[model samples]
Target: MRDITMYQSNGENELFVEQSVAQLPQLSGDTVTATIEIDAGQTYQEIDGFGASFTDSAAYLIHQVLDGEQRTELMSKLFDPQDGIGLSFLRNPMGASDYARTVYSYNDLPENGTDPELSGFSIAHDEADIIPLLQQALKLNPEIKLMASPWSAPGWMKTSGSMLTGQLKPEHYQVYADYFVRYIQAFAAHGLPTYAVTAQNEPLYEPQHYPGMLMLPEEQLVFIRDYLKPSFINHGLDTRILCYDHNWDRPDYPLTVLEEAAAEVDGVAWHWYGGAPAAQSEVLAAYPGKEVHFTEGSGGEWIPPFEQAFSNVMRTGIEILRNHSKSFVLWNMALDEQNGPTVPGFGKSTCRGVVTVNQQTRELTYTLDYYALAHFSKVIRPKALRLDSAASNELVRSVAFRNPDGSVAAVLFNDGEAEETVAVKLQGEEVLTFSMAPKSAVSLKVDSK
Candidate 1:
């Protein structure tokens, strides 16, 4: 019988994989064996942390979040490094999102007149989903970074006085800034301080079907420089400001805003909806100094099942690496079969979720999306540096990381049908052949020799 073995070493440990070369053992068809090893002097990449967010709705649907044992279990599964992926970053909605049961903001339907002095304001409305999720997340990973973005502003602040298709009234610019300050302060008071805030989600698209708003480039610049940034500074808040929480097709939007903000804001956040992955490079090229982030993208019902699984993983993992993004965040982590808690309700017939929660059984099964996320999150620890690597669009997509321990982690994906052999080159002279399954992904960690 022919056999094949794959070995990986990190200065501290060695990992080996052994299996039969043929599909099955010709003489003895009943058995198969595998071996593993750990060695010293070799190191892998240092990890930052890996994690998912607790959106407004996930907090409510997860029946026992506040309970101590349940909270511990949830936190452990999502944040504890030994037991879970140890997620270190989260994306929170400044107000309610499509995931919420209804549409509402902190200061909507105000009891008093809209005042810039911040008389009628509070995140009391978010106590339902936002607070519980943040508290639980922070408890699990105290170093977790929180990113807050609004799906829509308070209805009264919009042009139509509605959550959909309304732009912020120019007169309310300062008031809008105070709106952010109030939310940050309120959240901090609850022991869940946020790390950053995006001006708006999909600032270009106003979903009439769901609770969404539109903010123009000029308006965004005005808000960030004239309002948001200054407000944060005045309040002595360290929460950072991020611009352009939209797609790559509009790189100029954020670039212009950045030119206007002129270092007042921290970075640029982009989503994938309008076009190809290369769109990210456009932004990076224009503003090389600013950090680029892939804030939101996910598998939806429209794509076929096969493509969904394969593309989602490849898109998020390889695309993010290709674009030189700082991080990648997916939409709704968990959802029921029906995809409820959606604001105006999901437009598509099928719902997308990484982990489909079987309400009756309370069982969680990993979908293509989950596996795709795990391909990176499982191995590429947070804060892991994106080292240099090479791959084409057709053969295999990969990114290399230098771990804290000096070992390296490389995640590779082969979307083709036939098994493909890839050449993995590390350091200067070390090279190995890596064979990946058709339409599969493999993460190899090579410790420093």
Candidate 2:
């Protein structure tokens, strides 16, 4: 038996851990109990220490799994305070992705105008599923930052004249720019203001499956600097434009675009399917001031209880954290047990979402991804910057932050096979030291300097 205690550097407060493991041989299970001890003079991090964001994947999942009362309940869990993920950011498709039931874009009709202008364009295509879902999400967290990305432009705008192509016709440059402006304004009118928009999703790849369009680095630069930027300004839209909405494997795409266009774009977004974790480091090295966001990717197709062990969640969570990502938005928020609402001719594969909704029982199944995200979302609140921390060689990784409330918040994880001890310091003073359990994540809150 060991005694675990946490203390503040100023010697003002202390917390003690209390444990009560079952003694019965038949019912014994591995369990560690943590107890909090507070001294009279102690202060800790504020409740709004960390923030998180969510995505539009919840809508399709809700439609497929729950209906009416059931849908509302699940939505609350995603946005409501009692159980909501408390998301402050959301990612929505400009048109349709593989996650949607069908494929379509905001302006997917045949039309032509040299430097065509979208004077009468609207978002009638997304009204069915994306709109209603976004309204409910906003109702839950009005502060949520919405981001829009086009899986593919309107079919007619591409050189291939289809969603699955690698080029956008130069003839429609002005029209395409107007298309973006219309999208932002339309979504805003619906009470869901988009905070950001990416030039093109996976711009480097044109899939023959679902909706996808590839835009070259030069094309992106021209579109953003010469067309999109001017269009946004003309429309008086505040939504920021992000470039390179693709995988880490092609950091050069965003790098080249931003390096050449300079201040034309606000930031760069990356996906996780094509490259290793270290790929972001290359981009970060080149563009330090720019924001690097992990916009999409799912761990796998299932969420098992054992997967909750740090190796699966904590390990990967730390990797993303260490990569200098301001935020991490997983692919699907909610999905049916079978993992679908899949579009025809998309990818040859499917993956799991954060929450698994049982259509038959009206029961909600939260995955390791959900728990892992909660560990950060519940404690790290939005706009919180990554501070600093030190840990061992095991799978555990840690990051600290100085909260606006004059307190510090630190998240530590042990994703390896054995438990380890960690020491945390705030303002160069040792405040607390604790032995992290194997396969577990813990968040420490302490008063700021």
Candidate 3:
């Protein structure tokens, strides 16, 4: 008999696991009621994992506010598969992001000077909070994959001569490429090696207050093909390069890069702030050989009523995975009560992290984003493949996965306000029948026999 482990969400029971139901005889039916069909035999993208970012602000909260024991507990909840959500992928900033305590970069230079040799490059600022926090998370889940993205090329490398808005100077192209090499080497020296790196964060959007560099598709193509690729080869670094770390609204950016510098890029990273999730599949259809990654989206102070936040994340996870994205990552792992320790005048102050740590009370509160992420990260692991699954109607949405252990995990979300009775059929055989609460997310796991 195959046992089923189910987790349900209403309001109070956010991702709460219900008692397991013992297996029963498979039902024979010609006409089925509401049903979700799972075809494990048909598989799509191989999942890398699901997770959030580990920013300086988040690191500060973990290191300064939480005591040693509390820190351990929180880290376990965030990283450990057995003890917590088992997030297997993490996004790291190459330097300061809007979420950082202060705005800075690894290679800050005087306005009049440029670091052609990059002699002054350093990651000293990260050691204080970012490195230690990452080390602790690694201890909890050594297999976690870290991908870094730069908010801006250092001030001197840009035309603006500041960390804010600027474009990379034409002459500094090779030097900027070397800058990335130095960053990878510096992090490796500290025992935190990055697995992948995006060319720029929100490449098209350059804000006036914080660190941002606008790299047009043509410029990015030239840099990757002529400079960055050669630098990586010379250094013998195998870190994967992802392009167009921007919104789905601009699929042409990635498509253009793929057309011109396909040899230099491994995949495309997308942000959900402006486009539809289906746009990812469009890119995949155009270039089936390339990968699609959903890199950033978040729930926070700007999001209303916790339930809506939960639903938004759950819905997004289902849609992206169904659309061929191998990985889904949210932003900001943790933050203080004020929604930050954010860089003033840089980004949205109302932005929220996955979890909030009260500055005064030093207490931790897990946001809806945490539970939303847990529904997938807790069951679907790294290296798993997305199995084909389809709901009978729009009211119910789901994505199925075949794990390395040969088990099957299907995450289902009910959109309606009333309860839903869903009969799950595996390979045309009725495996189980369960009721889903209105506006709930569920992760159903079953052993493959």
Candidate 4:
């Protein structure tokens, strides 16, 4: 027998609650039982990490609304491996996202302005709250990786001459690439080294209200192959380039870019808004070596009864990983009680965060999204490999992993209407029996004995 810890979320007070260590029983002879058998010999993609984005609004609420002591406490719960979920992968906006307090870019210009040389490119705006909060997160977990996405480029580089709705001007392609280089260097100066960068955020849809830019796959191919790739090489930047930072509905979008510049582009980034996770697999089928990342998905107010929503999102995370995604990332990390302190009058957001900071009571409320993310992020460590696990029942979907620390963990989310009990087998040996409530989750981890 070996000591193992079980963390469960039954949609009650037990939200990722760690139960006392229990001894796991070994399988006896001639016992034939249905079980979820973990095969460590068959390993898939290496997990980069799991986390949510730290947008401008999230940083504002975390840095401005919460005091020093409160911010430390909250960040510790978010980033500390021992004290919290230990989210290691985070995404941020290079300029501004829809969740920002205002619609602005690194280099803004007057009504009819053009900086062909991109002389005024500066990330001074992020210095105030965004950079500091990121620095604090680094202190909590040194393995943290930061990815940057641009909602839109500076107004001068776009056809509409505004961040709201525009297409990148063909003449300023190299200049825009220069913008990315400066962004990486600027953030790196603050000790926040960027791990990866996407060409644009949701390049297909041009939102009339928020900052969005329309970029076709063909255009993105040119931007990545001719400009972005060469620019990185010229500057000797090791940061990887990921294409298609949009929903799963368009797997062909990333395939188009990878078809032309497969070597130049590193991977594909996806969102859960549109189609199914199978789209990720479709891309991987064509280019088996490329990486798939679940970059952004949000649990909004539209989904009610917090517990059920958590179950759904937790299921979505598992599905994404099973589809072979290296990382699973959600939308916003924190939002104000009003759902947002959004770009006033424009891009009004109703999106919920993992945590919410009440502007009125000045208390941080940990939402169901936080707990849903905790189940996977808390147990899965960086560089962990997903082990091949067979699901014995249809109602229960699960993915098992063997972390780098020599600990084996399985995260199971029950989607059935009733309770489910399944035997857990580790490398052909029955280790434990788990009974999970419907619309609930459980994480069982066994340390090296």
Query: Largest TM-score belongs to which candidate?
Result: 4
lDDT, candidates in the order shown:
0.66, 0.65, 0.86, 0.88
RMSD of 3: 2.2
Q: Candidate order by lDDT, highest to lowest?
A: 4, 3, 1, 2
Q: CA shift at 90, candidate 3, in angstroms?
A: 0.5
Candidate 4, 36-123: lDDT as tens digits: 8889899999898888988999999999999889899999999999998899999999888888888889989898888877788888
Q: Write the per-residue lDDT of candidate 1 for residues 183-298, one digit (tens) a residue.
A: 88888888877778898999999877666788998899988888888889899999878898888777788878977786787777877777656767776677766666777876
Poorest stretch of ten by lDDT in candidate 2: 7-16
What TM-score number comes out for model 1?
Answer: 0.84
Candidate 2: which pairs clash?
Answer: 15-37, 50-380, 50-381, 51-380, 51-381, 51-382, 53-89, 406-448, 407-447, 407-448
lDDT of 3 by residue, 314-421 (tens): 998899899998899999999888888888775557777888999999999887888888899888988899999988867899999989998889899988887777
Question: What are the RMSDs of all candidates, in order?
Answer: 6.9, 7.4, 2.2, 2.0
The lowest-lDDT stretch of 10 consecutive residues in candidate 1 is 29-38
Reference-based lDDT, residue 381, model 1? 68
Better structure of 1 and 2 per TM-score: 1
lDDT of 1 at 265: 75
Worst 10 residues of 4 by lDDT: 24-33
Off by over 4 Å in 4: 21-34
Candidate 2, residue 29: the lDDT equals 18
TM agreement with the true structure for every prediction: 0.84, 0.81, 0.96, 0.96
List residue ranges in candidate 3 displaced over 4 A.
Answer: 22-33
